[model samples]
Target chain A: MKLVGIAGTIEDHSYNRTLLKFMANHFSDQVDIEVLDIQDVPLFNQSDDQTDGAPVQYLKRKIEGADGVILATPEHNHTTTAAMKSVLEWLSFKIHPLAGKPVMIVGASYFDQGSSRAQLNLRQILESPGVDANVFPGNEFLLGNVRDAFDDQNNLKDDKTISFLSSTLKKFLTFVTTINDMNAKVAAADWESEDLGAHGHVDTTIDGLDMHAADWVDQATKKTNAVSGDTYVRLDCGVLTVDQLNYFLNSMPMELTYVDANNQFLYYNHQTDPENMSAKRAPAQVGNPIEDCHPKRAIPHVKQAVHILRSGQTDLFKLPVPSDGSKADMHYYQAMHDKDGNYAGINEFVLDILPIVKYYLGLTGQKLVKDPNATDALTGASKKSDDAKPDDVSGASANTDEAPAEKPAEEPKPDVDSVSGASANN
Target chain B: MQKFIAMVGTNSTNSTNRKLLTYIQRHFADKAEIELMEIKDLPLFNKPEDRKVPAVVTEMANKIDAADGVIISTPEYDHSAPAALMNALEWLSFHITPFIDKPVMIVGASYGALGTSRAQEHLRQILDAPELRARIMPSSEYFLAHSLQAFDDDGNLVDEQNIKKLDGLFADFQIFVKISDQLKNAHGANYEEVRNLDWNK
Candidate 1:
């Protein structure tokens, strides 16, 4: 394994530097350790970076080239020296050189407490999100009273300290090698494509349900109340009550939320079993701005999606919310349109379909028999049994009433199965 | 010294990623025999036609087959690898199978904050195709973000630390390649057996 030891202090007679040199010599057989001097590294400045200074760039490259880094620090004011901080600051420019880089920090000081405070401070800086340097989780090396610990030639005289440092270096070498081996093994594994055979057909079962049906029913019922003083709308087959409309939206075994064109939180279905829901929706959120309803981290993504939807560039956005284990919760957002083809709002649905997905992929012991009545169950055609036609569940004419007559809805095939197949192949 | 084939995924005339590859070649000049492989002359890969093998592709395959290791530097386009690079890889994957058990290292330079991390990931997936089977150097991903500021007018890496990093990667890569070569020889042409050998030892 190759390791680079960086002496944190720039002083000519620094104990930390001497200690690093001793380590390099001691571990010569197992590792090729090089002691890098940071004296030439310039104070980081954004303007200087524009010109691309040679010294700062060199420092960044050196750290990048190493398998692991050994930062031998010296204490000043109970913290890391200015030199160490300056090097870290330079490496953290637009590109983070230290991100995920395994690092080990050791400090040597004249005081009895050694440079423990400096090492602690350095660990915090290395772990900061911006730097993200992976410091060894435990086993700190603090050489206190360093003046008498080493011989005149800067060699370690203490047998106890030498043994401690040797064991730490050996463990550090193993850590570096293990990571390297794992990376090689992953790279060696063939993951580009797989023959999923007929497994790709499973995702096709859930395609093309009327995304706007629930909202359209709600709007049509509201208009009936305003015009005729009736709280229900008479449909083609039967009388549709306001309570039935609410039931239709909430009975889909998924969480539903709607945001208007003005980015307002209009409504969200209250889950009967709150504990089973992935995201909770409170009644107080109604009429609030969509931005306020989402956590701050998710606000930017929501705004971008809303902007894209309002522009009519694309009407659908699908994402998988990460879960604890192998299964992931799926979220789908579809843009709703008014009678004149004006953008109205968005309908968001979050569903946990891991069990269904697992069954289709043959991961579960269960078999997937094509549910002949799935289309009927999805379109509410099952509710109006008298008007239900076998062809009405075909998906070609389900949205004919709302969609323009010029463009008929295409047959909803199992598109997701093919997509999942492609992902499986990758 | 081992011979390595350095490939840049982009065919752009002034690609910074290509410049990065040239810098890497210079850095490893003392330790390895680095050769620059150009994909500009190769035609776009046609699945049916490439199965028969074109002369240019044949020559490129031969070069890869002869090299001890392969180093690729790529730029991300639309969150994936450039079409030109993918085309070449497809040809190599279908025809020669030069990457089978081969030692490969990936590096990238980009102007964006995420660098070419996404593209590198995409490339890793592609290289893992059953036919390619390239053994890539695992954990260390060299993403030189803000690459516009990473080099000087002379095309040398401005950051000395970055040069040292390249040096370290080359050192590890050399060892990895040597071990792979030893394993291949020991197994006596049984690719599967060689692949299954515990490489860490």
Candidate 2:
């Protein structure tokens, strides 16, 4: 298969770049791979897409010609780099070369655990409607402690790593070949002349075989109806079922633990991914007395907060939890009340506010841009499903407000110095 | 050799509080046998059912029972110790009472300016409860603030003041444990007399 390997970093000596190069060279016998340089791809601007640039056209043509795309990405602040997102934005708006294209993602990081989060995020982006890249499921090639994993020649040194990468490549190749063969069979099938069932409709026959599309649709509709029935509770914003409320709670970056007014540990949201969660809640802690949840040493303080909230002295209490310096830890306790303003429960929000704190403090070298097409310009690579519709593309557009702009064009040292100086007085 | 078990409060893999315990173990290498205990595996304390005791809890109790003294290096979360550490303590307090009359020292490392002063005070209150009846070292409270910067890459305490304070605290703890052990062994009514003796001089 002819593949286009996109190194998702612009750094001159990026490990991700070297990793892609190594993959291209090592897998030369099995697949024809060409590494695409994204350094000269101008920052994504929706207004300028109508007047295509040479580099943009070059990237689009290369992607169009390739049978599969390989993304080797570097993570920044627990997400994919801004540079990688910019490339996706430029490609997604117009031609949508990624749509129905076979893609695979891999990443390397200096930490003991590689860039798994970034790879997950990238898969989400690729699967989104506009991109619609057929990302391989459950295959992650994370080269951790990458500096030590590779040799002086930019080749992977460890036999185990090389074997793992080789196996993953083989699996990806099989997946691509299978998809291509299936598509070819479906295309060659004469569906027009196929028998129409009793309803005088196409019988959902594919390649002279029954697809059972009707049964699948019926089951899906029934499941959706069953899930949405009378399980909803009215909220200020809208009606939400217990499952929906849990989804909203878990969707938040923070972990939440709730204690009722009677000082009972009521509930905690089950984290979707335990590895990514900073705080873990065991099931046994639920239904226990709130006082019992805390160490005896901290019981008095827990009581005081409850008492204060019960007495209507304060509605909220906030504290910054100490961290090991990698992330900022903040805790917020809000007094929950009933419609009659009676104290109902206490809700605790444990958040890693380092990103927000750093952003405001200007400690982060992230750039901010103001553009009308900003929303469409950068979409989260997440929120894609295997059957995602083409029209479902708009929903995945990332909120421009949340996307950190590309890093400043110049050196970052001076910016850090000035920002630190400004923050010193605060 | 006097064996001391150190329990760190937080379950974070990158916990600075755990790093502080490692620093303590290194600093007091010649003084006592400091065993760094992990509370991550201990199930949450539940009544009646947990009273029968899981094998893991039984093992934890056994270790505590064998140890001469206990050291707790904690990080304050929501102005208290994390749930994992508390759960372990509750298990011990309920089933074993191993902390009763045990010489326990509390030290904390935090990212905040106050370190874990509030948590230490709260812990002291808990240890002094009638059922637990732990004899805590009251002379000094080692609260390391900005703990991320307190240690070097090699896990050694970098600040001279912190190093000096830890040195004194460990020495005082050793003396405290020795006296406490002597008092525990003292025959029937002699405990009152032994407790009144001026060990400071």
Candidate 3:
């Protein structure tokens, strides 16, 4: 049996990572272990399938192929690590990759009990899902005083624990081998249908659930009770009309969150208008704490933008949120100024322009904004006006003061790569 | 009378899974004594020759030896079983075929989507060892989805759907364990009887 050791931790000096290294060396002659990194994994989001920006596809494949997995986890916020849980969230796309897999969990921590509570908490989260972990006869490896557990070479110091671990592997191997032998032909019965829910169509697969998108969307305040000046005013609820919704939805390049300054979430145009719900994949995020939805790594950048917008500056920040291996980048523009030129709190807009780019590339159909008079008939601002115009388009006369005040018949084409790169820099 | 050991793998200080398993043990509490194995203490797995057999390993082996049957309640991680729990399994595998001919039931729970189906599948694959007697529970029975929210503070299944699933799984597991124990004690003589199982139920 190939003994795959799962190492989770993006950092270089992670203690759990070190423990994985020790396991690698200890089982060098007997097993093959690989460290699976969660760094490249985008947050899982189901709606990403409908958007031009899609989530990663290969991460789930790795978990499916592993024999016995060993997880080296660190404790965070008094429980299992966030990155670790994030990986699990991604895995939830599948029916049950972890269900019957033989697993060995070992953790390292600076504190006493060796991050035991975190490990235990993680186990609870794992077991809650149906893994028959060979937990009995009490299988726990808590390396309290983690410093002592590792030697000068950064390997496990104790020899006895190693033997026990080896023994555990033997037992697990036997169990795995036995099970596989019994169910040897089980793979043949998998699917006869061509559309066997391929690509996470089945809720049990990785493609079905959008964990990254969920996390990103979840960061915002989902519950919004409008409080205007003192009285709780109720804005329109339920779906709007098809024509109005379609114009509002397709007119803007970005996913717009119309906030009336006090950081209160007001409205977001549903992607698929109610009338055309079949072809439409509405944005999963409706009313949520906008801040909570950002990537942890990108939180600081978002804060900086929020700060600038709050301080009366129309901060235009562009970032390439990781979309699978390639960048399905988006541009964020927040302006505190109101429609009346009065200072409102902020009008935040997030636009996934990958579709626009793909359209521009001739790889897809109509341009992102297909309106005949691309600009607003009233405001004279083009529908894609807020979208960052690459230098190729930016240098055009439309960006100049001398350009025609009347609506232009054609939108200036942009240098897709350059503009996307520019958007990602912030 | 032969004794059966129920090993519950959980990390929560007050785990709902543990509480559920505890309630099940109570049913057998008067009929038979049960050993509740605590895994929070085992040392990290390293080669014994390199690190020596830690006391925790020996204690774990002792519990396995004393029990006629072992029931493990595993936690799901990364759509699989927790590494900590797996590590324990690794330790047990290294010690002996503690799972050999030992009757086992795999049950799982989750707070979201399809329950712990992934973890349970992984566990089933592990338990498929020829030496291990896996009393496989049907997918519908073993899975308790949105389980975290189902249990109240007192560990009772507040939702009817979850309660029904849990009850069915527990009942099946009890039968599986009892039958498995009887077959194990009878050795190969009762192996034929144990093999004739209605796994679908």
Candidate 3 error regions (>4 Å) = A1-426, B43-53, B129-140, B145-201
Predicted structure 2: lDDT: 0.67
Compared with the true structure, all predictions reach lDDT values of 0.67, 0.67, 0.52
Model 2 residue pairs with clashes: A124-A381, A124-A382, A125-A381, A125-A382, A297-B122, A379-A398
Q: Provide the lowest-lDDT 10-residue window in model 3 chain A.
A: A392-401
lDDT tens digits by residue: candidate 2, B28-50 = 88988899988766543433432
- TM-score for all models, in order of appearance: 0.33, 0.32, 0.35
lDDT of 2 by residue, A258-322 (tens): 76665555467877454565554555545455544545544434444455555544566554444
Question: What does DockQ give for each predicted structure?
Answer: 0.01, 0.01, 0.05
Candidate that scores best on TM-score: 3
Docking class of 3: incorrect
> What would the TM-score be for candidate 2 when compared with the true structure?
0.32
Query: In model 1, which regions exceed 4 Å deviation?
Result: A1-426, B185-201
lDDT of 3 at A183: 38
The full ranking of all candidates by TM-score, starting with the best, is 3, 1, 2
Query: Which regions of candidate 2 fall more than 4 Å away from where they truly are?
Result: A1-426, B185-201
Q: Compared with the true structure, what per-residue lDDT tens digits does model 3 show for residues A275-376? A: 543112235533333443444443433443444444422234333343352435443445556444444544545555666677666632334455685443
User: How much TM-score does chain B earn in each model?
Assistant: 0.89, 0.88, 0.72
